[model samples]
Target: MQFTLDDEPRFPRGKRSGIGIIGCGHIVQTAHLPAYEKYGLNIVGVYDISEQAMRTVQQRFHVRHAFASVDDLFASSDIEVVDIATHPAERAGLILKALQAGKHVLSQKPFALDMHTAQELIQEAERRHLTLAVNQNGRWAPPWRITTQLVQQGAIGEVLAVTHLFDTRFEWVTGTVFDTIPHWAIYDYGLHWIDSIHCWLADTPLTSIRAREYRTPDQPMESKADWGMWCEFVYANGAHAMIRSVGCSQTQRDGHPFWLHGTQGIIRGSILGKGNDFVELERDGISSRYPLKGQWFPDGFAGTMGELLCAIEEDREPYHSARHTLRSLQMTLAACQSAEHNGEVVPYEEMKR
Candidate 1:
């Protein structure tokens, strides 16, 4: 059988939504707007707490309307969806506001810091019959999307384990808004890896998680970096996953490599920005490599929003639905709890308590 998969990002085939952006920060300018424009999605308008920020994005992107406040944007009947790109702390209220205004929402990742807040937002969207999706864009990253499709197709049959290892310089967060986040590693950045694991193993129930974060002794104090993090997830189906992120590498050979092992075969690939990014499948004593085409930057962003748009047009739940994302959030919050107690294992159900 020839192995083929639909790994590309998809948009609505019928009706494209008009989206109003609520936060015009770095990500909006760099990834969100760029991807939306690339896919020809309608830009209804933009609003931000900072007028200057909204004005800058509006002028640069040539967006027609710049709302002076969140209410002003919500009042626009043209917007069918609102993209809440604000920090996690302020996102929940904005999401509620949007839902009450009868607009579907695309939320930034690590949906909420606590389980209660995440659950409430999903419930409100459900109550309003509106779509609420998370921008867990890493799922649509080329390597991850292909590998997930292969797994779903049973090309790698009954996955026994998955591992993600990444080593990179940490300077990007050093002086930025990201550095101030609590549990900065898992809450802010590691959510992508956590959510990817959930996507690949959606059927298996997660039992428990153990995680740890460390500051490298060699890392300079001035850098104020959380040098490394490690997490392990246990599943009810006797499968497991391990992830380690090394965020303070000074060496030139930075890479993000992942592996998935199953009863029948193994799948492995390096993530984007590495010199080589591709997926390889080995089964029945044969190995084949598939080269990937797109980068994670804008394509992943497109995938998240596109799924939401299609779901609305087709009258179905989005693959990136906020309800489905709660599982990933459970594991992420569990990892933080585990790390706080000196890497003690925490039950996935414990998060609900």
Candidate 2:
């Protein structure tokens, strides 16, 4: 059988409004600006604590204005949306300010450092009647996106289990600011996987989660973040999911395989960003491969902003809204808490506590 799926990123078709970026960090320089430029989105201005950083991005992207402070950016009537790409420590405050200024917001991943703070931000956005979306761009990654669409479309009847493994070197964090994050492996780098698991099984009742973080003797790390971790999710309906990461590998193996087992069929694929990424399905003893387009880097970035804009235009909740991501944040935070307790199971109800 031949199949077609809406797997590509989409931009808002009506009244593409001005977006002001709050941080001009590496991600903005590399992914956000480039993707926005490519998709023809209007960036009215940008601001960063460092003037040099702000000027560099402003000159590079030819932005209309580079604000001297975030207050100025918030005051500008040209901007209706704010992209808060600041680190988690300072992100919540900026989000609140943006919402109070009557602007929609698109937050970076790992939405907030804690559940209470994330919830507060979500509620504040709701009170202000503005769009607040998290940048869980992995949901738009080609392979994972297709998998979710297939499951939602009932191509795979009743998801039973999801298994994902990542075996790759993570030398980038060494001697960098990223290594300083607590549970950096799971929270900072592995957050996309956790968010993806939550997205696919959102309707299912999650019972508890167990996770562990480990360090290997051969691992090269100068910080507290271990290079390895594994997390398991238990569901009330007997369906479950597992996500594992091996960040110390000298070489990536098997494209970081993943399998989704459902009652009717099995969908298997490797995560994106690795070379030779692919997805396949099996049913009635027949196997078929689905050809995918686009990579995660810039496309996923575009998808997040696009969905937010679309939601704003249509007056509906974006698929990656902050309210929806609260559950994702709970699971990830619980994983970190569970790791501290030596892989003890943490119940979903107790996540807030």
> Cα lDDT of all candidates, in order?
0.87, 0.87
For each candidate, how many residue pairs have backbone atoms clashing (under 3 Å)? 0, 0
Candidate with top lDDT is: 2
Tens-place lDDT digits, model 2, residues 107-149 = 9987688888888898999998999999998888888888888
What residue pairs are clashing in model 2?
A: none
Query: Model 1, residue 188: what's the lDDT?
Result: 79
- Please give the lDDT score for candidate 1: 0.87
Model 1: worst 10 consecutive residues (lDDT sum):
216-225
